[model samples]
Target: MTALDPFTDALDCPLYVVTATAAGERAGCLVGFASQCSIRPARFIVWLSKANRTYRVAARADRLAVHLLGHDQDHLARLFGGATGDMTDKFTRTAWHPGPGGVPVLDEAPVWVVGRVQSRFDGGDHCGFLLAPEAAQHPGGDGVRLMFLKDGPDISPGHPAD
Candidate 1:
């Protein structure tokens, strides 16, 4: 395997806290690998590391909610990004409610969307979940400036698969 440095290629893409609830259990995590993949039909995709607890929950989820973090929401980013759901309850520390398909929608987020899982693909260490937007809510704001690489704690992936 070729070792490529992600640090050099790390773009300041929007950061999101993606949550999925299945079988009465909820899981969430900070996500960086996501984007709008289609314009005509308005489709988006979020990639999750297989080792993440959120991925395990999302695998059985019919829908997933994506919440964009504002510039000052570093704590939200820490709960989902710096901490691992395997050992901690990330949801208990955040404000959220059940949304479409019972997925957890972060209340503090300025913008959020719930989408039905359209397809899933294996991307080696991560899995790509293509979503079809079913519902969206944009609570008015300055369109919260997205969190980036330089904004939060630099924690190493707690799991081996990450």
Candidate 2:
């Protein structure tokens, strides 16, 4: 393996539950590839796997909701990461409410942001959606430790990567 491969594999990054809505359909999935990409305009980039239902919905969605899952909320992570929406109604099983632009917001997420899609980029098997913040919610409480990718090693992706 290359030198970068091991380094990347050892990194522990926060996981997210990204949700989007379009054409009256809503979808969400677990995400490990996302970050604040810009500060001048305040942009966040969320990379969604092309093979996932959330990616399809996001393509036509005007906005998206990025949620921070607590370290103890692995069950929430499993719900979004372990099951495919193609055959399952994931939202119905979880607690969420419609946010800006009809995006589904996870009620349990301690911290969350609703952003309008500013642009999209082609990134091999995954696509990046640049978001401009529209709203943010931070429930004052203990700082919930973020769930990391390493924390969900057993979580089979809801959609297999191409």
Candidate 3:
């Protein structure tokens, strides 16, 4: 029981699927730590766990695609969040196309953005990737809600803590 655990445990925000490709290697993972970080310059930050395969590919990738999963897309969220790239080829199992800078864009996401990696920061076990959006697709919302952490209670993380 520490000061940070309370804050971290209480957060139940929207989930995102972050995809990236580098040197012909493709990777993606479910992300809970992503948000709009800037206003004037228009920047977003996505934090990837260092122990995940997506982070390894993202290290050499110049761009990434961030997707907002609808509440109904629980299976998609579980696939990305509960499966590890080291053992599962998530891209092949899902529908996607090569986006800007070879980043894979999930077709199921209601809203998505392709952005260039402008900067990176070491944030303990995870690293923050700052993105400058280059392109986006916002499908007309049909009252569909974004998926939240609490929605995926059955999902067991593919990459467990060390």
Candidate 4:
């Protein structure tokens, strides 16, 4: 693999905690690989690392909820990013409500969207989950400044090896 400095090249976009539930199991993780892919159909895509517990749950899920964190929501990021779901119940520690498709939605999030998985594409170590927006809600106004890399250091990867 080509060695590159992600710290220097990384763009600070809004961080999101994506959650998915399927077969009585639920998983959520902090995601950095996400973007709006299409305009006409308004499709969005979020990529999850193959090694992430969330990805395994997502594979069987019909829908996923993407929640945008505010500048002060670092705890949410840590819960989903720093710790592995295989060892702990992330949802039990956080305040959440049932979202579309019965997915867990973090109550502290400023904005969130529930989308149906339309397609999936494998990209090396991550799998791109293409979503079609089914419902969305933004509790905060448009003036809210989302958490980004410029706010602090790039910390989404959560692991030193990554």
Highest lDDT: give the candidate number: 3
Each candidate structure's TM-score, on Cα atoms with residue i matched to residue i, is 0.89, 0.94, 0.94, 0.89
| Residue-wise C-alpha lDDT for candidate 4, range 1-162, written one tens digit per residue | 445656537676777899999999989988877989999899999998888889999999999999888887878877888878888899999999988889888888888899999999999888999999998888655766677646633454543324
Candidate 4 runs further than 4 Å off: 1-10, 152-161
lDDT of 3 by residue, 1-162 (tens): 778998889889889999999999999999999999999899999999999999999999999999999888988988998999999999888899988877899988889999999999999899999999999988675776888888764777899744
Model 2 lDDT tens row, 8-122: 8888889899999999999999998999998998999999999999999999999999999988898889899999989889998988999987899999998999999999999
Better of 1 and 2 by lDDT: 2
Candidate 3, residue 109: Cα displacement in angstroms equals 0.9
Error of 2 at 70 (Å): 0.5
**Residue range with the least summed lDDT across 10 consecutive positions in model 2:** 153-162
Count of clashing residue pairs in every prediction: 0, 0, 0, 0
lDDT of 2 at 148: 84
The worst-scoring run of ten residues by lDDT in candidate 4 lies at 152-161
Candidate 1 TM-score, true structure as reference = 0.89
Cα RMSD (Å) per model? 2.2, 1.5, 1.3, 2.5
Q: Over the full model, what C-alpha lDDT does candidate 4 score relative to the true structure?
A: 0.85
